[model samples]
Target: MTVDHTAPGDLAPHPVDLRAGELAALLARAHNIPADVHRLPSGEPVVSVYYGLVVRIDDTCRFWWVVPASVGRRRPLWTSATVPAVAASRIAGHYRELRARPPGHLIRGGYLTADVLMEHHTASAPI
Candidate 1:
């Protein structure tokens, strides 16, 4: 498990606008994507989806696509406030697009960045 050193005042409380289990159910029912909810060591709930993607709720109730990394902080694909069903569809589409990519293809530029980010992440992802 990774250790967080941020003081309590600086730390964001566990998200209340979104719950992991509820999002998982939404993903399954709306997008046919089977998602799993797991709690962080800090007790924050997160949703694990296809292609090792992670969905989390920030303090403001915005959904975040977080890339898990062994080193450095987790990266966010995007942060925005949206309905659960829309978020589920977007996550599912991203998963499908990732799965559709051919293996060993050239990785460059932003794609390369994303690939490297993926490598750094997923080291401890449940999916």
Candidate 2:
């Protein structure tokens, strides 16, 4: 089976698909964003992390937050050809928000919606 790497908004296949080791190295430096590189059934490497952040490198080496379909249909978060560090920082913040959310807020089973991932958490929100 051919695994399509075209994310929601892309018109064609991405030219630069980071190898597993390269993806792992980027995540390894992100101390707070617990992540691991895993292969798709088609053998494509994807970086999986908490809060349903399954990242893919594409569109000339940019980072994208690929959302799981079980949760929602929001567009993936694309970093637009920026450095990995910027993507890492955004991912770290995204993780923090998801971690801070109150139980049953936007999580279902073991998955979460991209909408909740982008929402701002308030100080008064119950954890």
Candidate 3:
């Protein structure tokens, strides 16, 4: 599906449709944020050492991703996206590529919404 290009400032989030196996594999190879560096708890730069993220994939090929609002918190805020299978596969593929890259490359400074996944959905995203 094509991504909506409206500005992100007023955008709302729904559920993130993800490929389960793809998401799991991505987390397996992802790195945690360093404690020394201060950063936002949500949106881009989410991976942390304390607790991992949650993901779900459906037969329709839609997927959802959820992460705790705070470190080690049980409650989570989730976001869904409208991404086609090819795009989803590409996202998974990027993680796979990163698995071979250094830790610094895994740090993602991006955002996601219901209709739009990220800048990469339409163009290239710095990995």
Cα lDDT of all candidates, in order?
Answer: 0.58, 0.53, 0.35
The candidate, 2 or 3, that scores higher on TM-score is: 2
- Model 1, C-alpha of 98: deviation from truth (Å): 1.9
Q: Candidate 1 residues 50-108, lDDT tens each?
A: 44466766555556674322235333344444577777777777767555655343242
Off by over 4 Å in 1: 1-18, 66-76, 102-127
As for TM-score, the candidate ahead, 1 or 3, is: 1
Query: Which ten-residue region of model 2 has the weakest summed lDDT?
Result: 118-127
Best by TM-score: 1
- Tens digit of per-residue lDDT, candidate 3, span 1-127: 9988889777654223224434434444442212111123233322222212223333354544443233365343444543534434443443344345444423342223322332223233211
Judging by lDDT against the true structure, name the best candidate: 1
Least accurate 10 contiguous residues by lDDT in model 1: 105-114
lDDT leaderboard ranking:
1, 2, 3
* TM-scores vs. true structure, each candidate: 0.55, 0.52, 0.27
Total residue pair clashes for candidate 1: 1
Q: TM-score ranking from best to worst?
A: 1, 2, 3
Model 3 lDDT vs. the true structure? 0.35
- lDDT, residue 47, candidate 2: 66
